[model samples]
Target: MISFLRKIRQKLLSQNRVTQYLAYAIGEIFLVVIGILIALQINTWNQQRIENNEELEILLGLKDEFENNLEELNFSITINTKVTEACVQLTQLIRSNSIANDSDLLDDLLVRIGTFNSFDAQTGVSSEIVNSGKLTLLKNDALRTRIINWLTLLIDQEEDILFRSDNYTMNMMPFLMKHFPLANGELTKKLPFDKKKYLQNYQEKSPFKFNIAKEEYLEFENQIWHHKHNNDYVSINELNLKDFLKITLQMIEEELNKKK
Candidate 1:
């Protein structure tokens, strides 16, 4: 193509058709500019296609991740519900002013609360995505940014959910294990059938109010119950979990659909 252009220039100069040569040269330059623009447009389009494909791949992976998260959330809710139920039972046992002095019932409640562990062992798809940093891999920069934001909220909420709902391990469950009076006269670090919420429905209420050996069991029960009267475990959990999860996942889907 260069050789052809040079030949045309030589012919025009040989014939001394200066005006015709200038017009031809201008026409050639315009064609080259047009070709360059077309090539650039094609290149840009291809790059965009590649980026969108990558984004699609990420979306599919995230969809799978979210599905897994949903499943795990379901399971978490089940476990937490059971734990809450146990806590409720303990509350009832203590609330009965008559049972304040009953060692057997206290022992049973402690035994029930004793069965607590960290729900951190619960694995979910959202957790995997966050850990993998794939949540940040979304290709739509805007959408990617949104995903990160919502995912952070989701993860934080999940953690809060466990912390508030269960509090089973260190903060929640009853360690019924008796702390025999130490030789040093120090108390044992055991619950002796005693113990102690918000992502979804936790009302920040102390889940347990009874200690098997507390001198003021009767008073504690009344005071704690009065203070926690507004703590509707089931209703609060349902409301918060419903609202948070709905907003989080919907944000995820909206961001996905915005992808080209």
Candidate 2:
């Protein structure tokens, strides 16, 4: 094509057709510019295609991660709900004064007292996107904002988990160990703390009975307060985390629907 155009220009020059040669020269320059523009446009299209594919992959990965997170979060919520209910039952039983000698009730309360539930959201895909500077690839403004907000939500939940766990560790466990026998028994497995010694120490009673003394009852009340505190703290955060997961999952579905 270049050779043919050059031959035309040479012929025009040889004939001394200055007006025709200049017109042809301008036309040739216009064609070259058009070709360059077309090449640039094609390159841009190809780059965009690659980016779209990457965004889809990230979205799919996030979908799987969040789906699993949602399941775990729901389960945690259920467990925490049970903990809250058990706390309420124990509190009522202690406050009533009518059920003080109910050893069977004590057994149930002991099992309930040992329960704890927590959740940790998965951030593998989100962390990669944020760290690698690929958040812009999300394309959907709503989706990107929610994905960024997930980190903040996760941090809040983790802080609450730590706070509640500290309550159980520093306040509740020490109180229980000091006042109660904590003998080795089947109940050991149910409690969140170290069960090895409890398992080895008392193998006779499945649910060891503790005679509720005045001081022990007082300590039980104190321990129940801490348990309730932790339960409330965890329950509220768990609900919030669940809500965030649900909303983010909805946004992901919307984006995926758009792609389909």
lDDT of 1 at 219: 49
Query: Mind giving the per-residue lDDT tens digits that candidate 1 earns over 1-260?
Result: 99999999999999999999999999999999999999999999998888677667766666665555555555545544544554566577666755546544444444433333222322354456557776555644655564555455556555554544453344322332232111111111232223241112222323344334556565445433432332234324444544554565566577577873
RMSD to the true structure for each prediction, in A, is 9.9, 3.6
Clashing pairs in 2: 184-198, 184-202
Candidate 2, after superposition: displacement of residue 106 in Å?
1.7
Residue 143 in candidate 1 has what lDDT? Answer: 51
Error of 2 at 139 (Å): 0.9
lDDT of 2 by residue, 187-252 (tens): 433544444645333346635334556657777787898778877887888888788888888888
What value does the lDDT take at residue 91 in candidate 2?
A: 80
Top of the candidates by lDDT: 2
Backbone clash count, each prediction separately: 7, 2
